[model samples]
Target: MKDKFEEAKPILTTLMAAGHQAFFVGGAVRDYLLGRESGDVDIATSARPEQVQALFQKVIPVGIEHGTVMVRHCGESYEVTTFRVEGEYSDFRHPDHVSFTSSIEEDLSRRDFTINAIAMDVEGGIVDPYHGQQDLRQQVLNTVRDASQRFLEDPLRMMRAARFVSQLGFRLSPNTKEALTTSRELLKEIAVERIAVEMEKLIAGRYVQEGVELLVESGLVHELPIFRNRNNLVPVLESVTSRPLQDMASFLSLLVHYSTIDVKTFMTEWKLSKATKNKAHTLLDGLERLSCDPLPYVLYRVGEELLDSFRELMDSVGYDQLHPKTSVGKLFKELPIKSRADLAVDGKDIKELFPDEKPGPWIQNLLNDIEYHVLLGQLQNDRNTIREWVIEWNPHDPS
Candidate 1:
């Protein structure tokens, strides 16, 4: 958004007034050129990290060693980094060392891709050193330099390359594609967490099928954790053409549905958060039950919060046919209760009904039956009605 640039313009002007060259750079500039809404603005300046910190009142030395600091100006944060060149990448992740430079061209040259190498000055002047704009015009992704050398420096770029295909709906240059295939094995050197971040974006991108096909064709899928050595599952992933995955949970649910891998294994291998794993498991449960369970029961099981995610997952995997005649939203709307907290009676009330029995699983079991009946419209949710109904209720013989 231009508002973001407007908020960040003062930072550029400040650095420039201090006799340093500063410009709007990276993804924001790239997105601006493509007429897409950009996220946070990143600034590349000839000012050193210390100079940046000195120029700003509320500066955070988040990655000062890497020549980056968070400049809080006008109630907005921008990543202001010194123009620098990186040395060899021994670990295939971070550069062995970084040295500040005065030339934006040298700094841009170290970028991963040409599309991300363009820069825009504070007054809207363009710096097209690498012809990144031309590459963007062609809708092709190319490494800043030699593809193999750039990949060797950081194998994560290969994943980023594939991710860009999905995000921008762009094709990979011939040389870039060939280098990605030859250097696919180098992905093992990359951390799974980093790979997972890129993979999530790729799966959720607009051109997701193109990204997945790149992984399969380049043999890069073999280097990944769950999909590794599972060439047969390519068709399963490629089958996701109807829509992009909603999130990591949906992606995992789709893959686990077709693969022999369990949800836990997928979660652990992908290094996903516990919450994501739980959601994926819930989605899988909903999918299985949707096939055989009644609509009300499914709505009760999935709850309103997951109703949308459930529908999206079902649609992504072509399981929408399971309830062709029923509307999931309408079913949810017609439900008497959405969750246990919405119940008119609590465990205490159920416990009081059976004074002779100790508080145990029966309380929950009875509540479950009550919830089921209430959802089926056989019992009213009114507290007094339920209180009277419990007197004649028999969990053992409800019929």
Candidate 2:
């Protein structure tokens, strides 16, 4: 299990051999202790950013000003940050200034949560100045210092606290929860992009329902209109927990079942990109149709991309129990029509056949008829057959 840590050992050993103190820190250490695979290994070192860059041949000054440098080795990148203490935070997002220090304990004291403050030396073992292991054993999240002061330093930490609770399935200490509730309004002082990232993580966490309930309880939902009445999200949480969804679009679609806001309004509130909004809406629209009896027309209209999304939603919503009559699993396997592009004819063919006739509703009507014929297997999807049908058909004459 620890073999995975071997990849990062060389980098850590290299820095430490150069008369610098380096240790694995932050979420990676927390995850390692939780018996989960850590995605990224972050190293905290007493060396300054310039010293870190000089120690590694390939270095990226990603956040050098904030005492962070990216070191790449063996086709992987690790964020190596100097042990630094932050000054006062007036803007509620960034520190007014940071002073690099040589003590890892001082650096860990300024962290947001106790669990994240623990650091592990490659050979010397764990350095837990804040008793983070105790909190991890108790399944509690507490700030390293005063919760209010920590939140005031960077308001995003409040959201991060809630997100970590969701991610780790831990309860926030009483003081931490109170601090988050009191400082909820300060979330506005943070950037929308940062808030959105944390919100998405919160929603996707294993204990999402608990996280959202905390958001409402802390009055954080009121500051962001998109999250207002998010208490109604209980059903959404229930639907998604059955099957874990990693894609953001699928997760947002599940919320549509609980939200009355239009896609545009929801996206505007969350500051989501146009592509994300479109995909989420399409997934929601497909799920709504999935509630009805399986329809070839619906399948045809929704096509493959949305059909896959609907399948994921069905699995999430307990499709086996909730939709026994609806054979989503089977229907998904046999999608009748994949897309409009798969149709044999085009607008140009329709225009050529009816050159004398003006382009109008009749053209669409003929195309619909052809699509129906193809869907019903009554006609082969060939240009000749569709063109012949168009030639024989009379728009003004009734059948």
Candidate 3:
């Protein structure tokens, strides 16, 4: 993991050369110690935001007010935030204000968790003022300070705690777990979008079932709109917990199925896009119709993308265990027409054949009819076969 930081080490070296303290901080350090692949490296520096910007050639002040800047180094962009202690969190989301600090301990003290508060200097020196490495070794997540106070500063920390259970495959310390249960109400103060982000990560995690159990046990599930009024969420949570979902749509598909609400309505409440709602709808339809496999019609109707999701969803529900089939994917691969685009003769070809008739609803209906026959193998997809079949079926001379 230390070798992985070679790309961003120059940023640390640059800050150090300028006589400002800088170190690899947060998840990057935690993940490095755990021997996991870290996403992005965050550098905490004693240099103020403006001073940090001056040192970088291409600097974007993405979150200057919060002491963060996007520094582009060697064709890679890195997020660099100044070491600071946050003021009171009035909204239970963001810090009302931040006070910059030179002491690393002061800056790390304000962090959410012990594992996340650990920092690594470029010379391979670790600054663990919060004993984060010990927590990582124990495979437990604990707050930097009092659990209740840490969660009170930002209620989203509660959801993040659950997400960490799935991501790091770690359990919360007893004190942290109690604080999460007590601070569950603070989650309602958080916006749905923030919870949605953490929920998505939580559901997609390696230990997703455990994460969701934490969410449910901690009463955080009650804060979500989709699960607020619902009771007996454990069965639904247990169903999907056994297997990993491929994407947010698949996860939402499993969740929405156990509910009385429609997929569109529930997804809309979570602030999901129209596209995601539509995809989940497609997956639900496929799940009901799949007899542990797809037929030719199902292949043509469900298409390729939904078929993969349906298979994953089926696994989540343990569908294949009862009605196992051989070579289900082979059926889709062998389909003659996956979509209208695969047809040998399209609407343009139909228009040319029916030159005397103006384009109208007939064109679309005719295309659909042609595709059905092509997929069913009743008619060959060759241009001449389709043209003759079209003329014969319609029995109209469009001279």
Candidate 4:
């Protein structure tokens, strides 16, 4: 973890060289102690945002009002935030105001979780004011202060707790778990977009089952619109507990499992993208009769793009066994006509063969018929065979 921090350590060195105090902070420091390679290293500094910008050549005022600035140093970007105390958070999201301070203790105190609140210097000197190190070692997700007060400050902290539990395979402390259950409704005050983001990460985590259990046990899943009335919620979660779902789309299949609900309506309620909604629909739709040894027709129906994700979902949930990944790749690769575009004769070829016939939806219809025949092995995927077949099939026309 410290080696991962080496790339961005120069930023702290430069800040300190300019008569300011800077240290590796947040996830970077915490990950370093946990011996995991951390990404996007962050720094806590006594210097103001403008002071950080002045010291660095490429600085982005990403959240200057919140005492944060993106500093690009040594070909890496680091978020340098000033030590500060936050004002009341009325919206359960952002604090109304923040006052910059020289005390790192003040900044660490405001963080959501104890493990995330730990700070470390360049030489690996740790400042564990909240005993984040102890919590980290204990694999406990403990909040920095009275859980309810902190959650009252921002309810999304509850979701973050769930995500950390899944990502780090940690358990929530008794008080933290109690506060989360009681204040789960505060998530309503947070935005759906934020909740969706946390849910996505939570389901994609290595310990996703644990996270889902926490979501169920903590009663946090009820706060989200998409998960409010799910029947057989345990089975829904158990479906994904086999292993981490590949992505949000795969995770979504588990969400809509065995429920007497319209999938599109459920997805729309969650504000998912058309592509994601379609993938989830396609993947789930295939699962109805999907088997380990699907016939050629079934493979053709699933299409080349979605078959893999379908297989991934099936294998992840232990619903069915899948052949080797290459099996589908080779099967699709060898298909005579994999899609409409692969048909031997397209709309243009069909129109050229029947110059006297006026074009209508028939061109597409004929192309579909040809593609279907090619996939069924009843006709060859050759331009000449398809043209002759089309002219013979449409024998009423002059030929």
lDDT (10s digit) by residue, model 4, range 1-399: 356577887888888999888878888777778887676788999999989888888999999999999988767777899999999998888999999999898899999999999888888888889999999889998899899999999999999999988888999999999999999988888877788888888877889889888988878888876667664555656666667766667767756655555677777777877888877876776666565434455567678878777667657645544344436566677778777777767788888887888888877777767876787787899999878887787542432
Candidate 3 lDDT over residue span 1-399, tens digit each: 365588899999999999999988888888889988887888999999999988989999999999999999878889999999988999997899999999888999999999999989997799998899999999999999899998998999999999899877899999999999988988888898888888778877888888878887888888876778776655676677665576778887787776556776777778887888888878877666666433576556777877777777767767668768834588778888777778898788889987888888788888888887877788898999999998888644434
* Each candidate: RMSD: 2.1, 3.3, 3.1, 3.2
lDDT (10s digit) by residue, model 2, range 1-399:
266467889888888899999888998889888887787888999999988888889999999999999999889888999999999999887788999999999999989999999999886388999999999999999999899999888989988887887787899999999999998888888888788888778866887767766776888767654655565654444555444455567777876765565677777777888888888877777678766634565567666656666666767766657646876546645544566688889777887875776778777777878887777677778899778776676343332
lDDT of 1 by residue, 176-250 (tens): 999999999999998999998998899888988888888888889889887786778677777754478878898
Better of 2 and 3 by TM-score: 3
lDDT of each: 0.87, 0.78, 0.84, 0.80
Checking candidate 4 for backbone clashes, the offending pairs are none
User: Which of 1 and 4 is the better model by TM-score?
Assistant: 1
Give the Å shift of residue 264 in candidate 2.
2.3
Candidate closer to the true structure by lDDT (higher is better), 1 or 3: 1
> lDDT score, residue 43, model 1?
96
lDDT for model 2 comes to: 0.78
- For each candidate, give its TM-score against the true structure: 0.94, 0.86, 0.90, 0.88
Q: What would you estimate as the lDDT of candidate 1?
A: 0.87
Query: Candidate 4: misplaced stretches above 4 Å?
Result: 1-3, 230-234, 288-308, 316-319, 322-326, 336-339, 355-358, 373-380, 389-399
Looking at candidate 1, what is the lDDT of residue 136?
Answer: 91
Sliding window of 10 residues with minimal summed lDDT for model 2: 390-399
